[model samples]
Target: MRDFLTKKITDIQPSGIRKFFDIVSEQPDAISLGVGEPDFDTPSHMTQEGVRSIQEGRTFYTANAGLIELREKISDYLLFRNKVNYDPKTEIVVTVGGSEAIDIALRTFVDPGDEVIIPQPSFVCYEPITQIVGGTPVTIDLKAENQFMLTPEELEGVLTEKSKILILSYPNNPTGGTMDREALIKIADVVKKHDLLVITDEIYAELVYDEPFTSIAELPGMRERTIVINGFSKGFAMTGWRLGFMAGPEMFMEQLLKLHQYTIMAAPTASQYAALAGLKNNWQETVEPMRLSYEERRNYLHHALEKMGLTCYKAKGAFYLFPQISQFGLSSEEFALRLLDEEKLAVVPGSAFGKSGEGFIRLSYAYSIYELKEAIQRLERFVTRLK
Candidate 1:
């Protein structure tokens, strides 16, 4: 037999986040701040709705695009919340999760040899997914000095004739950085100049710590060219439900919907109905409380890291703390490994995100304040010994 797998996939690396997670799982009494999942369960109402879905025996596949009612609610949510408008009937397609939404959008838009400008240290999926589709990833290693927000200059520098897409994940992962309206306008100008389509992953849209989250698509002339990705996982504490959606212009969505139909068929039926109930109640009941909890966790972790003499950009969104581990003369991986081995504490190496993340480690604050506090004590012990 010849080689089993294609070189494209074989050459791609597995997620850095998962590597530490696996190791931590084997360590007895280990405290992992690695995975970026919420500690909260699916709110009772949403769970009950899913239960209702099963009780009513409405477990059949939904429309290829999803329930029109759910789509309408999503549309309304986007309009009222993110300041973007899409016709639910034609423009929104609920997906398995934001992960699938990203995969489908990249598949539909990118062609072989096309260049995708991705800002680092971003979510780990974008580069590999671009490669899987035969697209070239052009990385703009974001700087902490700039608060990890992607700059227009940084974006403009990487443009090429083959540049087909720009993935903007604000209220970002790993670093928890966010871009406000002014920052977005500058990016929009560059996108317009380059004529690039954007996949704005606003999965953390509801968790912005400062101003309300703004979608790049909300800007003038950007909606026609941007696909907004969001989901029920983080804010709604429905990660297991596997429900997410995409909002974009009809031209892109019609074809994206066709691809989703052939590939996924439709998102799970019970999950859709459960999500519908979530939206019908406007999501505030669950989301607001989770956001506040995450903020509290963020503050506690931020202060703890500060007290340890580690400096990092204070996260403005999402539930992560990316503190620099370089001062101790250890690589991100080494620091994480030593911490896990010696203190039984687990955090993801920043290098897992991208090369620019080499000297940092990412700690998710989605865990309870109690766990975060315990994790901090272990981390403090580790850091003190290192010093």
Candidate 2:
């Protein structure tokens, strides 16, 4: 069995975020701050929309590109929010999830041996997915000093003749970083010069707290070269719905939809309706409150970590906190393991995201304030012992 396994697949490690939670399942009483999932339920109206779709016998397949109505909704959404226009009929492919968009986008644009420049520590899937798609994953280690936003200088340093695609994941996972509009323009100029395509992961676009979220696609010369990936999972709390979409130039989107049709056929029927309802409904009625809650949680968690004398980088975009634990003289994995073992609290080792994540651990503040308070007390107890 081992001999028959594909060497490429075998080389990839299981998700680091899930590792501690497996221990958490045994601990029973253990509090897990590991998973990036939102603690909120999908808004009731959206759930009812899914239920309605099924009750109305709409359990069939959608169009290969997704329900046209949903695509229009997504189209209006990008145009309104980001000022980037995409033709709903030609440039959108509804996917199983943002994960699938990531996969298909790579399939559409990346050829074997193409170099994909990625920034770390980022979401866990990018490197493995790049490898799986037969592309070389060229990673740029992002620093806390830079707030993890990729600089033009850093991006320029990694470019080569083989560099075909660059992935920009702002409202970055694991680190919670966001790239401001000013910074994105500089990055865009470099990308234009190099003629590289970009896959910008904007799944957390609506949840940004610091300033208005900026999409690279909005920058001049970037929309044509960029694929925008977004979904209901993060902003609409629709992880289980598993609905996402990618928008790009008609040329690229045509290829993405072709691959999606063969690989996934279509996203689930009811999930599309559910996502449509999410976009159709008032943002203030549902997602805004959730974003505000996340912002509050972000502040509280940052304060708690600071009060513990830990070096916590205040990330303004996503829900996770990457608090440095290097002062305790332990690897990020070692710190996370001991904290889970003795404190019965679960968090992810930063190295799971990438090697650049060493000396830090990721804690998702998407949990309740009550859960956060309890976790902090346990963390304080753990930290006191280290001292």
Candidate 3:
């Protein structure tokens, strides 16, 4: 079996974040902010729909491209919410989740030894998935001074002829940084000039606070050169449902669709039916309240971290508060582990995302206000003990 496995399988590194979780899994009464998922339960209406489908015997295979009704809703949602237009028939493909969508996107575009540019202090999956497909992951560190935003100069510096894919993940995981229209325009200009293809992970698109989350695909020429990856996970608290979709140029999506056909065939049929309901009538009622709750939590967590004298950038979107922990005289991992072991409070080390995250620690505010207050108290006591 070992001899039969491919060289690529041997070259991959196990996920760094999962290692910590495994060690702490048996601990008692730990207050965890380690996972990047929403603490909220999947919306009841969506779940009911899934149940209804299963009861009605709708448990069969779906089209490789997914249900046409679902595709149309995705197209409509993109256009209505972000002013981005995609053809339902050609540009859209329902994926297992944002993870599978990202994997498919990378596999379809990246050839062996091709370099894919990723902004660091971003998501953990990009590098591992790129390596899986034989692509070289080129990381560009987004500076804290720039509010963790990627600059055009950074993009220009790293991008070479071998760079086939550029992943833009904003409302970014771990950092909670997001790009506005002007920032996206700068990167879009660079992408256009370089003739590069962008695979944008906008899963947290609906969680913005101060400014609207702009898609690079909305920019001129970018729509044709961009693959938009989004899902119901962050926005609708639908993480367990494993539903996501990709929209891009027809020619590229054709290749991706074929890959999906061979690898997974299709997303869960019942989940597709439930997501169709989510995309249609229940979207506003089920999703907006959760967004508002997350926004409130963001404010609470940001202020609490500030009062505790930790340097924190005000996140524009997503549910994380990444605080600089260098003042505690420990690396990110040490700080995180010590807090979990001593204070019984769990937050992810920033280094789990990338090397750029070395001096910071990421805290999620997806839990209730009462729980957050309790966790913050533990953190405060932990810091005092350190001193």
Candidate 2 residues lying further than 4 Å off, grouped into runs, are none
Off by over 4 Å in 1: none
For all candidates in order, the CA lDDT equals: 0.91, 0.91, 0.89
lDDT of 2 by residue, 117-223 (tens): 99999998999989987999999999999888899999999999999999999899989999999999999999999999999999999888879999999999888
TM-score of 2: 0.98
Query: Tens digit of lDDT per residue, candidate 3, span 327-373?
Result: 87899989988999998998888898999999999898889999899
RMSD of each: 1.0, 1.0, 1.2
Worst 10 residues of 1 by lDDT: 278-287
Weakest ten-residue segment in model 3 by summed lDDT:
19-28
- Candidate 3 ranges beyond 4 A from true positions: 1-5
**TM-scores for the candidates:** 0.98, 0.98, 0.97
How well does candidate 1 score on lDDT at residue 318? 93
Q: State the TM-score for model 3.
A: 0.97
**Residue 47's lDDT in candidate 2:** 95
